[model samples]
Target: MAQKSFTASVNAFRDKTKAQMRDVFSEAVQDVIETAQQPKARGGRMPVDTGNLRNSLASGLNGSFGAPSAGGYIVTLSQLEIGDIAQFAWTAPYARRMELGFFGTDSLGRTYEQPGNHFVGAAAAQWPQFVAKWAARVK
Candidate 1:
């Protein structure tokens, strides 16, 4: 029947869309990892938990659904620092308005006594652009 054929087509389209979203999330993680690498460093690469990044993005998208911030996506980067502390506590600090925390600190420590400026490199610098790109593909 035509109804059966239409159902199959819709299912195929859904599958394809899911695959595309996954690809987008993977690329976003790759972008963060690549940007985190320090060129002059000996290893020339940094170990990033990309799985976490992927999960975070998925969670963000899931969270965004039916809520005020629904359809929003997040990718976490842990290598950047401010002074003696790792700057990004949750996700792209320099770019996204997100939760932040400091390493080797306490509930009330001097590490955050004074606010400091943190920067995300050119690739991961724009939060709005990143969000918009993923939102369009997330269904």
Candidate 2:
């Protein structure tokens, strides 16, 4: 009687796939950032200037497949400044209100309308397509 044993290694395949996926994800994130940075039309009734808001926009990616336990890659888009002032002036607080027109007027007495800056919302809307493109790259 003869006994035969075979060993198959998948480490190389896994590593290569992981690297490719990372690259694809990085590129997709950059695209999202660029889209978010584009100047959005003034949707507010107050006609506020958007130059500063566009300039303050930024994006970043955190975590990786290198450490799955730490959670997968996360792409974040945000304003550069920190604290309540920044948050109210440019970040989510006032931005969301402006975009959604939740309030009639801001502290500065600027009137709002439905659908504001749409910065984050626009980027999020493109997320599905971005993921699909990244997946296609990996495939």
Candidate 3:
């Protein structure tokens, strides 16, 4: 029947769209990871002490915040759904202090004026551009 044929077509289209969206989102997250790793003098925005913070960056779907990767890692995009949320996070305990800065000593008794890095903020600023770039890739 025509209705059955149309239904099949619609499902195919939906599947394609979802696949494209997942690709876009995955690329965007990768871009953020690369951007965050750039050096301050060069292009890196994240603070680097032991490199743990840099390695802790991760992107997960549906609020899954797993342990930080030894290196950069991204969730498999095939599991992404049409309405799933993509979240990027740093699992480091001091990630907040690095981003927001700490002007005083901590419980560890070692601290000074640590200015906010605004690293993630920098990547987030590119969100509009990411959307635009990826939107064009969608069919």
Clashes of each: 2, 1, 2
Give the C-alpha lDDT of model 1.
Answer: 0.39
- Ordered from best to worst lDDT, the candidate numbers read 3, 2, 1
Candidate 2: the clashing residue pairs are: 99-116
For candidate 2, the TM-score is 0.53
Task: Give the runs in model 1 whose Cα sits over 4 Å from its true position.
Answer: 40-124, 127-139
For model 3, where is the 10-residue window of minimal lDDT? 70-79
lDDT of 3 by residue, 46-128 (tens): 77767788777766678775566734354534466668876667878888887778899888898789888878788778877
Q: What does candidate 2's lDDT look like per residue over 1-139, in tens digits?
A: 1222222235666667766756665666655655655544533232246444433333223321122211112323221222212111133335555445554676789775555656556675897799788888675
Give the Å shift of residue 38 in candidate 3: 2.9
Q: What is the total number of backbone clashes in candidate 2?
A: 1
| Best of the two (1, 3) by lDDT | 3
Q: Which is better, 1 or 2, measured by TM-score?
A: 2
lDDT score, candidate 1, position 9: 100
